[model samples]
Target: MNEILEQALLYDFYGELLTSHQKEIYEQFILEDLSLGEIAGDAGISRQGVHDLIKRCNRTLQGYEDKLHLVEKFLAIKGKLHDINRILDEYEAAGDNAGKLVADIRKISDEIIEEL
Candidate 1:
């Protein structure tokens, strides 16, 4: 996964667990794509403080992921859905293979259900 995308996913899954001030600073750094200096200027903190806060936020979010595995399950389900879509596309292109494609879709769906 891309680093930024992974960060975004971690934040999305566990951000509400963070304090409001942590959320605000993290949003500015990650979602708003602000530089450390920019965030520090806006928050009236030192640049080092902003950098350290962001780093700490990253660790905190990652810790939640380590414990919960929500992000991992989400990504797995997403991949399964993509596989189902691909199978559907193939089924459409190969009308004679409907039975095989349908079976594939059912198998993936079963996996998704089990994960949920």
Candidate 2:
């Protein structure tokens, strides 16, 4: 996955574990695409301080993902769902056995739910 997308996923999964301040800074830096200097000016910290905080947030979020593997599992499931969608499209184009395709999709969906 792309680094920015991976970071966004990690932040989505683990951000609430961060303090409000950390979350605020992280959101500005990552999600909002703020420069460190801009964030520092808004937050009344030095540029370096903003940089360090973002780095720390990255490390903390990555650490959580490393230990829990929720992000990994989520990405895998998302990929599977995408594959399922592509297969469904193919089945539709083929114009045969729609019932079987629906059943297969349901089975895959059920297994995903069970895994969760």
lDDT of 2 by residue, 1-116 (tens): 89899889899999999999999999998899999989999999999999999899999999999999999988788778768877777777787767786778868776885765
Q: What are the per-residue Cα lDDT tens digits for candidate 1 across 1-116?
A: 99899999999999999999999999998899999999999999999999999999999999999999999989987887878777777777687757765887777776776655
User: What ranges in model 2 sit over 4 Å off?
Assistant: 97-116
Clashes in predicted model 2: 0
- The deviation in Å at residue 25 for candidate 1 is 0.5
TM-score per candidate, chains pooled: 0.83, 0.83
Model 2, CA-based lDDT: 0.88
Q: Cα lDDT of model 1 overall?
A: 0.89
lDDT of 1 at 36: 94
What is the Cα-based lDDT of residue 70 in candidate 1? 96
